[model samples]
Target: MSSPSTQPFAMGGREFVAMMASLQALQALAIDAMLPALGVMSHDLGVDGSNERQLIIGIFLIASGLGSLFPGALADRFGRRPVLFVCVGGYVLFSLAAALAPTFGALLAMRACAGVLSSGMIVVSSATIRDRFSGDKMARTQSLVSVVFMIVPMAAPTLGLAVLELFGNWRWVFGIMAGLGAAVFVWAWLRLPETLHPEFRQKIDVRAIAGNMRIAFTTRSAIGYVFALALIQGALFGYINSSQQLVAEHFGAGDLFPLVFGAMAIAMAMANLTNSRIVMRFGARRVSHAAVIAYIILGATQLFFASGEDETIWQFIPIMTLNLCVMGFISANFSAIALQPFARIAGAAASLQVFLRMVIGSVLGALIGQAYDGSARPLAVALVAAGVGCLLLVMFSERGKLFRRLHGQVEQA
Candidate 1:
């Protein structure tokens, strides 16, 4: 494979960001596109209870976390492009299989497998970004990628509804996912260059991989930020897992579910766009730290006001939008901070970071989702707890220091 710097990029910045965003957005597409179909899936699959429908979403995340553990190492050993191709291929195959599933268990299994494969796309795309940029620039680039990525969530639910309406079945949704994956796969094959530097490539050895993993874990800031990111992601996932039920059942807004979810996604996207511009001046720590504190306050207020009464759609939507707006500031910055300490092990580090984030978030979010008791109280309480956890983790990561930006600390890949 050619060295990243020696080879001319097949695509420019706009196309690069778009391609990377699409790869990352695939996971969102898979999850969000199924939101409108959950009720149908529950009935068709014989899933009992309202809460169990969340498993269709939560299970994919859990499986993605587990499946993410190995992709980083593979990407490090082989190369980003090749590993990505394999992931996209597996994703396409499993997505197609999911469409043909005859039982609920079969569908869940297929979705889980597809999620595992999709984890590679997440890991490799992140590692690729790390290979090309670092520090505030990395955060900025990621925020830009997120700006594009959020489009998927904003449109996914409506797209799912449209597909269901057109095809008259939920199975066609998975077929759409498969087709989109195939298109991305071909685009990537033709345009995406290998970003891993030849010098940084490591052999696929158990001891070496273990040593690298130890390095990532032992690094104070990396692991601390990883866990913090996980907690915040847990809160986000909790919202996602319970959103359909919250809107459809609680508010009786079945047809309006997509608009509500899309509004929140738009809020997040706007925040990301703003972060991409301001992060360079304020620094990742300052921006994300402030956002987390605000998130805590909002969560607390949401829990306080939302207790003992049903929150009207107006009240709930604005509060949730503000809460998610805070997340837009947190996610990209935390990810960049967590990956700041490693270069040669970018792939491995990205994998471990994503694995921790996905698993912890999946489990914590699943708990909150399963605790759904016909109200948004559970979600509010869970968000506050997650915010507290994030604050603690961030404090530990910074060695009790807050908001102090280190000059000349940016890592160059």
Candidate 2:
């Protein structure tokens, strides 16, 4: 089958990549930008206990995952632009609502609503990318997009802190998010044309959506990779959920939490930049498999330092940064591998895969976050468990094979 890039695209390649990255980057902004405000938000909203405050991030993720299932089906029928517009509008509205939330519970409710809307951006953007590229080409494109996406994570906490310092209110952080949403909305409206083809549009029926999802899930390679992605996401979420407490309080970074967090994020971005340059030559399987093995090794190393009470910040930072760097290689390639069977139903496939990864992964991460005990051991343990579990799932997906490649592979219709 011909790749979607064979058709004339409305926009040029560089612009397309930048726009898609910006669409997905909003989610990163929504989450990471709020990191610096967690403690202050909890205090202002009268939230009790360190652990309870984590619910802010956890609830948003779970809601995003749960809400991911529908947008693809809707987009498959209606076209991507409408769904993108509605999702962005809802994101701006709920962000405003969250900024005005009077209680912790109310803030969580608004956050959940905002997360649900934000998920559409992810589903649509992935579907758009899939509409253009396949196999290693898709993987390379995703890596490039991620390289750009990583900038938001590196800067978000610092931006959030700036808002807090200038306004002395955590509410202004959400206000800033709303402003960012508006900018992205304008970009999408002007530049993003409908990528879904007319012939590929399916009727919006429950049975059809279910069948599409089932096909995506039951495909041997896709299922294994999807589950593995979920497991890896669990480890990332675990870090995000408790990063404030871990970096600020345990490591004594305090006001410098953003600097430490950004330093770690730079490693992941550089890994993605490298992956984009090398994946075409090495093949997605070879590159991702090697990265997973490296992940497990890094996890083990972190466990060594974390299992003891005397582990210092210097020891923990390097190993943990390597683990996240490994993720940059694993995630895009694994996703490209998993979605190889769904050329026709790329939207449905992306939606269902994202749903599983977000929902299941968020829960596992929340468990790890709640287990925090003034030490890094819980995160280290979760990291190890996630790496091993992901490796197993990948083996199952590849039928016990590792690092095998199908030369000149392309997505199947």
Candidate 3:
């Protein structure tokens, strides 16, 4: 295979980032938009356990992870555009099917299928960005994408609530998702170009695919950062899985849920936007390392103060916002660092990276979420553990070193 080109598409930088952000935001929209509807859907679907209601979110995440494992190879083999179109189509179809599902089991099955298809967007968007840039530039670009992508999470629950209010049914939430998917599909179809260069395209060979997988998994930084990303994401997923319950049940602020969630998301978006501007100067490692340390400190503080039923919304909001803001710094940088060595097999590398992050994070997060006891203690404790674990992983990835810029310095590990 030929070396990957740094400028494979003709689009301007801003437009490209917007397009990629929109594609990536699909996953966020799918998950977050359904949050406000979870209660109503649970009652309608006759779900028995309070914890099982979260399966509506957890199932999609797990399915997305399972579905994500193959899209990179498929994108590398067939090309990004075609695979993306097919995936979006499946996402649309299954979303509609989910709305029409007659039983809870059937709805879960459709959601899982939708998640599988949704992996195409996540893998292909990252691979597309990888095809165009590398190093800190890639990190900066991803931060920019995240700035735009965060808009969905900020608005999705509110949007879901609005849709529910307008239609007076939870099923319409899925309909809205289908509508959004269709719109994005049409936009991508009309404007997006294939980013994979012909010389870089790989044949569907098991031996070659295995070799690339080995390269991605064995690289010390790649694997370490992958797990770090997963751990950090686990904390975020735990929050998402329990955000509705935490705010409504614990704080007695059911109506204020969207405002609280949106505020946190806005903080994250602002952090990513700031990161996009400063990442090139400070480097991905330095920024991400500082962020992780901050995350740990914030998590520890929140855990200490938020114990038992005494925690208040005012106490929870600021700490969670700051922690998630730090997450904005960590997520893009860690992903870029992990993908730095795999230009030749970016699709596969991104697939595996996302697969591990989503599967491990979603599962661990779901477990933490299920352990919720009408208090923020479980979430805080889980986040503290996740932050510490992420810091250790970063240390291992850098061979006991931290905060060194990767732009000019030789990697010690």
Pairs of colliding residues, candidate 3: none
Estimate every model's Cα lDDT from 0 to 1.
0.90, 0.89, 0.89
The sequence of per-residue lDDT tens digits that candidate 2 reaches over residues 104-210 is 99999999999999999999998888887888888999999998899999999999999999999999999999998999899889877788887778778889889
Candidate 2 ranges beyond 4 A from true positions: 1-8, 408-412
lDDT of 3 at 211: 78
lDDT of 3: 0.89
* Residue-by-residue lDDT tens digits, candidate 1, 36-130: 99989889889877888898999999999988999999999888989999999999999999999999999999999999999999999999988
Highest lDDT model number = 1
lDDT of 1 at 86: 95
lDDT of 3 by residue, 268-348 (tens): 999999999999999999999999999999999999888745777888889889999999999999999998888768898
Number of clashing pairs per prediction, in order: 0, 0, 0
lDDT of 3 at 192: 80
Candidate 1 weakest lDDT stretch, 10 residues:
1-10
Candidate scoring better on lDDT of 1 and 3 = 1
C-alpha lDDT of residue 154 in model 1: 97
